[model samples]
Target: MHFLPHHLADLAALAQMALAFLALCLVGRFVGGRQAQFEIDALAGWGLLAALLTLWGVATTLSLRIPAAAFLAAALVAVIWPGRRPDRAAWGELGRLVVLVLPILAIMATILPSQSDIFMNLMPNAAYLVDHGTFPTAGAPDAHSFLPVAPYNTQLVPFLGSLVIGGFQAGGLALFTICLYLMAALLFARMLVTPIDGADARPETRPGWAATGFGILLVTLLNPGFVPRVAFAGYGEAPVAITLLFAGWLACRAMVAMTAGETGRTSLVQLALVLVALVNVKQQAIGMLIAFALAAILVAGYERQIGWRRAALAFGAAALPAMALYLVWRVFVLTRFPDGELKPLPFDEWNWGNLAPIFVSMGKVVVEKITFFACVAVLFVFLERRLRHRQLDATGKALGLAAATFLLYNGFLVVTYIGHFPGVMSVEAHSFFRYNTHLALLIEFALVVTIRNRLTPWLASCPSLARQAGVAAIVLALLVPVGFAKRLRFDFDQPQPVVRQLALQLAPELKDDDRVALLLPGDTNSVDWMLMSLLHFSAPRRPGLDVKPWDHADQAAFDEAAAEGYGLAFLSCTKGNSLGLPDHASALLRHGADGWEPVKVWPYPPVDPKQRWQPALAPGPLCRS
Candidate 1:
């Protein structure tokens, strides 16, 4: 599953992706320097600082090139600066990461974007920001549904993709998303490897850094709610999940540093940057950061290990950035898109009295997610084992942080349901499993850190075991995405990518004012309007590619279409049509004043990664009726 040197093309793409990432971190390093605490590595130093910088540019200049140019300068400085060079240990860690997870990177480097959110949210919004260069002065055009959702509106992952290859290429987005997860894993693993001062006498004897880190990545995917396809599909959860882990790590480390009498200045900067990332990544993130801070204070102030003054300092450091970012975004959103209508539910639907059922519903969801409970159960088991004696060490502290934050964050979620989302979504708690995923890694990594006391010895004896298991996981991660691409389900949704491919194939001939409509043999109401929406957003300035599904049964429908200038129509792949699309297959279409016309059928083929996901445009219309 590891990347091979012989795969030069993939290697180059991965390298470009990695260098782009390091370039962002380079800027972070230069901006932070001695003011930041990167006790392990500087991966999360700026915590979506690139995205924030890009947002400001979008607000002002409206070009990613501005931030790209800045990062390019950082890249140049990185090329010559002796201070920016990786230390020997860091170099070795880099090599280990390459060998252990190269295949996973390969998967990240190759997959195309097929997720609905890419079409509906990220890509359209990225295009809007780059094109308009400001917060939206108005709402979505009536012809298109490019309504950007709040909080998820931040374009870090998409911005990186655009920076890598023009705009929002799925491959680039995937690589960056995986890289984001990798950064979080490294932070967690580093925290795992390093013991609190004076807690472990033989910290040097610990093993499994890269392997354990890679395992942390696996734990994230192991999440029952984590559909790898969706996570990689340009949604905001994966980023939120990973960045929360990053912020959680930084927050906990700040307290640990406090206990060890490390200088507070750098710690404050580190906490602040991640806090900025956290708040911008999701609306609920401010609450999550508060949970983390409270957990940190509880653990650090245990028996007054750190005086209240220092704890208050750490609290101030975290709160200040979170408040500033939250307010900045709030003001931006309020002043610009005050009528933003893409909310999950309206406040008028709120029912505060529904808390008991919502709580029970949430409990059912939690109980159903055995994976989540196992995560918590491991913490309980480890905490029990470790605290058999009445002593709390760094491992114990992390366990408590995980437990404390888990309870607090879940409480915050209940508030959200009551205040903002109590409606039909409240029945199942609206993607409860998926939302919990944001904190899954923190708990999983905490368990990884705690279990070391039990596993490190056997692992030390069988040093190759961790490496081999991690290698297998790497193999599985690479192989798993292949299975997704092989079918048309959530991971690699049917028709969306293929429809986009068909649109691109037909784009050059499409007139700027023309709207495309799908001529389905029959309507099952499938595609969820996704196929047409994707095609509509496929072009720049939207170019009015307006896509609508054509009803073949009614001549009045055809007349209405002609009234609306529907000149281009394609025979859509439908069940009655046997889902087989022949390349150049002729179909009947009412081409405006031209009356009935025979046109080449639009091809919608199944995605097969084995064939590099080529759309199999065949030779005949397999339409049954």
Candidate 2:
């Protein structure tokens, strides 16, 4: 009976994720056109997220049912419509890849919610949304109630998932979002291996292209940060990063078409939708959006395909909706919650001394994660250009745009780190590494394309045995670093049985009308908080019971709680330490050289005495009214 709720919850969440995936695929087909399988996958993921954000905004402002109905209608139309289908060969290839990837996806989905960020803010905000159907106001009384008013559009996906799956199991949302990253990676792989327009029509080049693309895909998949690690961490960076990749991919396609003197209307519209979604996901993506716009204009001017007027109009048409949405959200926040505005760090606090260390650390990360493949690709392109005595082609032009964006985005990061300046450049300096993943991926994509374009002809001329050997060598070379990095960084250990037992024992002690104060240590792990929240969720009196951290509580607050007969519990306490509690409370808990004695705590429904152990809590002055 105890295990049933967990099973039902997982099943429900899985069902909801499937429905979302189907709806997204349909929407992607409707908006982006039926292109390659990988293209369709990328488009579907992008469209789904964009639609979800727009509907969520409307739902939060108007009514939740409206968005629900709208989504159902869209999904209905997408399902009933006769969409283009991929050929047998394409399906066969996709199936093979799926077989290879599914186990990793399953493991990732199962363990994702255990990530630390869920407790810090993600799960709490999601729980608030599930209970209230909207963001909490600044006036609400609770721990971290001020979070809702902050710039956190990233929470919407998990909130939406919680609505469908029940409450605050953001692991489900993370699993669904991972689809976007997988699709984007697959799309990059497909583009590299497959022949794009303007490719040499020579039949001999096909096999070499296939081999090269496969090798690149293998290397990319093996990257530690690419798969299960960052993908399932439930970081807001996942959506923003994937969206930027999609935007870059679309922009590349558009530039390629324009270079051939044709306007790629479908690609351009898709690009616009992606950019809008990017900004909504993370405010920092505004920089990338602007950089993309500049790249679009510059490419147009250089190629003279659509001319300056049409180019400007096209770029504006793509960016305006996103800009408008951002403006509206900004206005709403400022007007509704003026006091919730974030203050910039003082410029005087900026540590210029940290610059050298910051650069060195960032450079090392880049070299470890990105530099090798990027440099090789560039060198491949250079050698090809030199040997062939040819000018830059369409792929080369797109590469230029990607390279420029990469540089511009990194430059922005440098300025940002200097300005924000988190003190002491240790692993904390690497905190921003997640933000850089997208740019690094983009650079890799551009390089892969350029290398494919230049090397396919040369590779086609080589003997079959030599080509096979070369591909094997590249894969081995890439795997060396991946072996060292060992992609699994997260703690996969399940929560201890003692924690669960303690939570169950305390549930009956809680009353519907009572408020419970949880006094957590200053250095408490997020997992501890997550377990505590789970305990509260499972309590018999959960509906009216209020469980909160009392880190801000004073002596008077404790005295009042005791007078009112409220429940209080301390987690993992020891002698001589109050864990950030006030001095008066500290003395009570450590009256003797040894710590306070534990007392028996009862389980719900009164279990046998033999099973009961001494409670972690002991009576104290603060608790004696």
Candidate 3:
């Protein structure tokens, strides 16, 4: 009967793989379009499905034979399947897409705890919600009740985790992330179509759509702060970025439809929903809101058309509830603090006056942080423009506006972050880079659209050798760096300091309600926070006792605990472990009569705490010291 559990697990894993594949298929169908979209979608669908099935087979509790068969079959199919065709131009486009997705995929794949470990943190919330018949407003307090002031409640991300956990799968975040990437890619490709209708300077070509999509991927991936975020940590920004880009496409479509004879209400409604959802994803999306609204207004003014009023209304209708939700959260939920201050910096901590300084910092950001693919986007913009006429289109203008808006937004962000960045750099630096990447995605999307009209003719006009060389260059540019970066960062591959090891070692000897303090001696503060959060396995009332340098009371509390003979002690054993504990505590685990017994220790190296997280460019590292 217990073996049946293994069989059932195998079945469940298979089903999850099938589900992921089906989702990819649907995405390809919706986003890819008629020509390469279908083929590409089908290939992606099958590849992901195969990968999923292989993973399931490998993980199943079934005898190794089942997994062996699954992996062998998948490998066989992949080998036999048509490899990427040798069309250099098409391959070049595909290369760009891969480059764009790498950072997002890397972060999504890594950054979080292991699937088994994540369940330890996420399941309690889900079970509580299911038991209560609703999602709770806060984290659990006592074993049986909610906390009065839950500091680290998993409200938003946990719900998504819960949905996946309910089904006993580890891929919800991955699937959601993948879908967002696919959605943005689709929207970007569709926008590529809209500007192709005219004999304007840029003419439609086979490479056009690919170039456009590739461009979007490049700018978004290479965004100023994106690399740190992806290479290091994920902040649920990728989906939001994808959503906003999709919203831009929808808005672009609605505008063009209005320009043409189609003023259907459905399109307007869809447009509105996208806009509203964009607003809900994050408050900083306001920059986008203003940009899109202004773009709409500008389009209206340029055309002398009054009908855009209805379109704008539809967009507002979709957006209003989200806007209101944000206000409700801000005014009531988030802002109900002492003196009405939100406490956490709202819309990030940057303002307008520090643009010059921000730009000054760009040399480091661009050189050390920016990816090669992103640089290609800027190059492509120049190349595409030179190849065609000198003028920009509506898409170009809108993109220009979006880019300018982003710069303005960053200027504001720099001002706010100025106070924080007094010494080295502020945490807000990462946030600014992350937020600005959104605008970069928008600009990249617009550039792609403008150039989409002219790509085919350029390819047709060029010698096959030239086209092949260009394509080879792009492929080399994208693939080589990806290989190097993956090796350098190893985001998904790096194992976190074993929290379970620490937990198991510490938990067994201690009586219940034992208060344990976690202090990082040489690591960044974020690491301490992460470790404390992970320490929740004990169901502690206030698990993470961060012992900062200035807290004498905290030291006194440890002194009191030592005098009282606390049951067990867990010390951060890393070299930089500075707990204000004497050197004897480090060596002997006890100070004459003051320091507690060191029953267990976990070796968490002091990671650089102040690293940036730019989801658009890269990921930040997990700082769990």
Candidate 4:
């Protein structure tokens, strides 16, 4: 299969991921035994992969290349190990859907790196790893080298891509994200169809279950929050949310199985690994993890399925891996990145007075946004029946637990946003919808699972109409992205114009030994950081070129760099003023003594002419007298 040079990186990444998937499956089989189902095996495999990556990241941070080498060796061993395959019927059924969905996913992954977050942090972090082969430390020269308290378990895909492609490839990293999304969707579909103990698994029920599972999968795929974030933006929240969903689903399954006196050792182990991976993926996951654990305990207690002692033991077992991984990362952060503390915002003084406005704002968002309101409705619908029916079935318990987790998740967000920004409730209001997209998916899933049985009879009665409706729904779901496509400016076939212009303007003037101080704001979405990444990616062979963020407070560093014969680069918008010039650079520019003159200003495409400015590059030597 002949492939373009650019496509080779993504292809290699996909190949490596396939290898990793196989390895994970083998490891899962080794731990969970041959009796484990595909869902259990898949979750277990992902957990093992997460654990290995966690260890790998720590090792990289410590500058120990041995673990990376050991991981490759382990992957080889996993590939060689013989393992039992999934149930033939189940595999065949799901394989068809996977095949249908894979190409769309591939296309999305290819173009996904254009999402701003990739440029903001994920890409930079991955590029740093590719360039230096280690995590940023306190001693790192650039102030923005490593974000404080940012858990980089999510960056594993990008790191792995860098390893596979022999450089940083955004498309490759995005493919990894897409795989996680697909795996989550696959597991969700399998969970819906797979019967719990005492549930009717007859041929009649199979079709209904299959239809329900397809519905769930379609809804998840069509969700504005799930696929877009997973495929394009490379948000850690998507992976964390989906992993937690799978873990919660498994926990419910295990609880039901345990009640029936059937032990689910593999399920429990898989849950443990996923929870651990969740903690490592993002800090917010810690709260979600606790919520899931609590829901498990409550469900077990409510059902009186198993003894409290046994239930506690199972939950604790599932929590062990996550707890251990947390401790490991905690120690690593303390020793290596002491400044990496989990304090993004200050906790306001205890006050009921502070929460009222926040609650009002949150309520407004939930009601005003169609997507958020629909999700809220779904949660309520699931809760209405499940709460009233005290004599709950396994499905009821699962749905109930999911609802509880969703409620708890929202509560956590409320506390976080209100406590952190007491005065600016509007800020939380803006992000409230975006942040809760995954929670919405969980609610929708719970709603579908809970109501599927009731709708199955109706669906079976009108088979022809049902078939037409299903086809139409799928077609509509597929077409929905067309509306979104207009908003997306990125082209999979072409280089980003900003990147091209930055490279053209800056790369030639930048010498191997030159240190270029970026003149840009300290905002999280600063375009200068993206410029730095583009420069590094384009000129990988150029050594000893340091690109550091310039701030007014860093006057001494700027002065020292200028004194030491370094270069200065200013980023601006083609239609607007420069992002901001540092005080030292302004002084040098005014005097015209340091050869700080206007270089070529590269124009970039603007998302919105009114709000966003087109990227412009201005580079000059800072040290020339």
> Which regions of candidate 4 deviate over 4 angstroms?
1-18, 35-40, 53-95, 131-134, 140-149, 161-165, 196-224, 227-231, 344-353, 418-430, 461-500, 520-525, 538-544, 548-566, 571-594, 598-625
Report each candidate's C-alpha RMSD, comma-separated, in the order given. 6.0, 8.3, 11.7, 6.2
TM per prediction: 0.78, 0.73, 0.59, 0.79
Instruction: Return the lDDT, model 4, position 162.
Output: 45
TM-score order, best first, reads: 4, 1, 2, 3
Which residue pairs of candidate 2 clash? Answer: 599-615
Q: Write one digit per residue (lDDT tens) for candidate 3, span 1-625.
A: 1112233443432344334433334333322332333223433333233233223322342332343234334434433344522235544554555554554444333223332212333333323332332322333232122221111112222222333333423233333444344445544544544452232123234434344444444433433324433322222355445545555554555555555555534334544544544553434555566656555555433433335566456455645654554454444324232232213344455344565566666545655545533643564565356436733344544454444444455555555465434434543255444555565556555556655555746766777854574565455434544454543232333333343344445444444454544433344333333344444423332223322211122355456545555434345442333453333122214334444544334444444547433221111112232
What is the per-residue lDDT of model 1 for residues 160-264, given as tens digits with 9 covering 90 to 100?
434554543334445556666666545544554555333211223222545544544554455433567656555667776776666555556566656666654
Between candidates 1 and 3, which one is better according to lDDT? Answer: 1
Residue 208 of model 2 has an lDDT of 32
The TM-score between candidate 2 and the true structure equals 0.73
Q: What is the lDDT of candidate 4?
A: 0.57
Judging by TM-score against the true structure, name the best candidate.
4
C-alpha local distance difference test of each model: 0.57, 0.53, 0.41, 0.57
